[model samples]
Target chain A: MQELKDEVKKLLEQGSIAGFLGMIATTSGVVPHLFVADKADEIEKLTTGDVRYSLVQILRWIAVRHPDDKFGIMCRACDERAMTEMFRNSQLSMDKVVMLGIPCTDELRIACECEEPTPKSLLFGQSTAKKWDKADVERIDAMETEERLDWWTEQLGKCIKCYGCRNSCPMCFCRVCTLNDDPLVKRGEIPSEFPSFHLTRAFHMAGRCVDCGLCEEACPMDIPIRTIYRKVRLVVGELTNFWTGESKGKSPLAELGDGTFPIQ
Target chain B: MADESGSPFEPKIVAFCCNWCTYAGADLAGGMRLKYEPNFVTVRVMCSARVSPHFIIRAFQEGADGVFIGGCHIGDCHYVKGNYITAKRVAIMKRLLEFLGIPKERLHLVWIAASEGDKYAREVDAFTEKVRAMGPSPLKQVRFWKDATVSKKIYKSEAAAETPAGA
Candidate 1:
């Protein structure tokens, strides 16, 4: 932890970056903080908190105001993957960004079922990559058709229509969300009409979801929102042979490709 | 659930046709006097890709037992890649549908050219029958109907005569 703090401090002092973005321990818990040269002492509290925050989301916000400024971003493997896609999506400039990857503890990796827990620029810990069990997706897949329908109906019916899932999603960056659009989901409905609300979100996540788990964690209704997204991700992964949020390339869904998208 | 008279279930179908091809194809089906099931309502859009995933979901929510999308044959889209995008969207939409418990078959996507009036008639009839066998969409049971106020009321005077205003 001191090494990380010192490294960030060194980056700040040397003016390699105008500021560093990482988690800061707060009275309640850990939250995102911007470590700058002017506030050099603040680097002491720089830590990868016990909980996950979308560091890239914050980075995007900061970059919008300070577009030309180079910034050091502390990232987990998931954060790094998310960041990579953001760059690919033109949400951030790669040259303006420096990543200090924090390899997740094996315990955290296993708990998240994270396939790759080591970012390209590893600051610490051993590289660990393994497949997620996908038990949740498979369990739902195994259900009888009627049973599956009932299961999803009950699960999605619990939605309070809080944009919590979208708000927490690293991939959901659209300033004007389709969820709020009329004729898609009516304005001011509590249980945002069954299936469309959730399914629309899953469809949008098709080729883009990074399996970050933040949306699932943010759901107050405990909807298995990530499970649906994982289905789309796996579908896209199998079809395009491109899993998003990993190594780079524009998502095929993001454009009308050379007309040879494999459609079965 | 059946009607009050308990008639056989007739599945309501919503078909989205691309303006350049399938919509024209449907017109040809009529010109040729090709008889197909009258179970479908065709909504024409500028292109097949214009049918957003939510449109299909909204179709189901509005009580369509089946949602069919017909676009120009792959390479023949008037916009060049609109149908191609439609294909990709349908692929994604189908997966999400299956995961949400709707049988993937309930949502059908096909590439039919403007010259393929016979194909249009045949495919729609086939899909209509397929949906009939599947019975009502499980989603139809949700019965989420949207009501809009009518600007003109036909029975205002009659309603007042039938009952006291307070009553």
Candidate 2:
């Protein structure tokens, strides 16, 4: 933990980055903070807690406002994947940012049900084993079509339309969201019109959702939103052989080319 | 559209057809007098890629029992590779629909040429029957229209009750 603080302090002293985005241990809990170069002493308060936030989204907010400045961010594997996806989408430029990758702890790894708990370039901590169980996906797949429909209706019926999932997702950077579009998601409708609201979101997450599980955590209703997105990821994989943020490559859905997606 | 007892269920379908291919094929079908279901409402676009996923979702939300997207063949797109993107979008949209428990068969993507008038008629007939079998969209069962009507009534009564007796 001290090593991380010292590393950021050195980067700050050398003027390598205008600001560093990381979590700070507050009296209540850990919260995201941007430590500027002049206030290097604040690095002491920085903490790597089990709690996760959309630091990549925060980076986007910072980058768009200050395009000329170089920024550094503490990234988990999912955060790195989100960054790569945003970069591929031309939402952010990798050249203007530095990633300080932090490996997830064992507790966090299990809690998140993560496959890859460590970033590609790890600056600190030990990498945990991958947990790729798809019991939730399999459980839904096993149900009859009618039963599945009823199940989803019941599950999605609990939605309060808070948009917490979208707000917390690092990959959802669209300025004008389709969720707010009056035609797609009707205005002032609680639970927001069955499958359209949820399915639209799931479809948009196709080649972009990096299995961050943040959406599920942020949901007030505890909807297994990530499971739905996991299925989407699988479908995208089967259809286009593209995994979200598996490589620093563009999304297959973003561009059109001959024979890239042969009609089956 | 009526049956023995009452009006039979005629499923509403939304078809998005590319101007260069499917729309022309549909026009040809009309010229040939090829009988097809009248339930389908066609929206013409320049390219298949113009039919965004939101359009399809909106169609379903607006009470469409099925959505039909027709584009030119992969190598024959008027806009070079418009159909290619369409294929990817449809594939993902179909999977998403299935995941959400909406029958995957409710959404259909077909390659139709301007010359294939008979094929266009046949495909429309088949899709209409499939949607008919699927019955009303699950969204309809939720009674969104009823909610809107009820809310409007409540607002009207509230306004009337608040009005001054002299006025």
Candidate 3:
């Protein structure tokens, strides 16, 4: 804790970042909050949550509005991945931001089965987890074609279309979404024109999702949103041999010019 | 096979054809006297890569019984590797569809050259049959027919309630 505090102090004292994007315990839940040295005292109450926060989204909001000022983020693997993917897509800039890595606890790790629970830099907390379980994705993979169809139909039927998943996602930074459009998503459906609304989000997140699991958490109907994203990630890994956030400023699979880039 | 209500299965297939190859292939099928199901509504795009997965899903959402992407075969793609990306996407999307409890067969990606008029005929025939057996898409049946009024009412009321932070 002291080490993390010291790093925060050093970062703030450097005057490089305009503010710090992290989280604090609110009465309702742990929510993302922006901390600046002018308000550095608030860093004392900064806390981590078993639940995830959209801290990157908050940083993105400030960064896009004020591109000249750099900011620091206390991000986990998912947050870093989200930021990295966004950066590749030109949504965020690494030049104007400093990353303060925060590793997830063993308890949080088990909850999400995160593979890279630790961040690349500015890491906080003890490393307690390794490896990720692919069973969640494989279970779907193992199902009979017909059975899988039935499963998704039933699951999609429960959708309330609250947009909670999209809203909570740190990487879903689109100014306009086709899912919300009346023509594409057929506005007014709760379960949301199955496959259309969810698949659109999933397809868009193909090279973009950071595997943050916030979408699943924020889903009111408890849809297995991560399953689709994970499958996309796996597909991307196979097709492009690239992982979002593993590198900085790398080109995305969709951007590969005519597949002659030798991605695989 | 008439039950209480006589409802003949007239499946709705949504075909996404690349403007360069398959769309023209479909046009060729029209030029020739190829007889196949007219169930398909063609959505033309410049390239197979331009067909986002959302478009296919949207077709399903909008009452499509089956969705098909007809593109040029791998090496023959006019845009070099456009079909390769389409192939990769189709592979993953088929898996996703199956996971969602929609039969994987409902979504198909076929490489039909502009000259393969007969292949287009066969694909449409097969797809139409497959969709016929699958019956109406569950999404089409539920979102369009059942609880639609209630769902629309809830969607509107909730959308209006969202206020951007600090607004």
lDDT top scorer: 2
Candidate 2 vs candidate 3: the lDDT winner is 2
Global local distance difference test of model 1: 0.83
Clashing pairs in 2: none
CAPRI rating of model 1? acceptable
After superposition, the stretches of candidate 3 with alpha carbons farther than 4 Å from their true spots are A25-31, A49-51, A122-124, A188-191, A247-252, A259-264, B1-11, B34-39, B72-85, B125-167
Error of 1 at B164 (Å): 49
Alpha-carbon RMSD of each model: 8.2, 7.0, 7.3
Per-residue alpha-carbon lDDT of model 1 for A1-264, expressed as tens digits? 677887899999999899999989878888899999999988888877667888899999999999989999998888888887898789999999989988675556555766566777887666565667889899999998888877776667667888899999888788899988986787677555777888888888887788888898899988888899888889898777788887467788888888776555
Model 2 — TM-score against the truth? 0.89
Q: Give the B-chain TM-score of model 2.
A: 0.83
Q: What is the TM-score of chain A in candidate 1?
A: 0.94
Sort order, DockQ high to low: 1, 2, 3
Candidate 3: lDDT of B67? 90
Rank by lDDT (best first): 2, 1, 3
User: Against the native chain B, what TM-score does each candidate's chain B reach?
Assistant: 0.83, 0.83, 0.82
Candidate 3 lDDT over residue span B19-108, tens digit each: 888988888888898998889998898888888877777677677889988888767888887877777677777766666767778888
Candidate 2, B62-162: lDDT as tens digits: 77889999999888999888888888888888877877777789999999999999999999999999888777786665544346553343235447889
Residue ranges of candidate 1 with Cα displaced over 4 Å? A105-111, A127-131, B1-4, B143-167
Model 2 chain A: worst 10 consecutive residues (lDDT sum): A255-264
Query: For every candidate, what share of the true interface contacts is present?
Result: 0.64, 0.54, 0.46
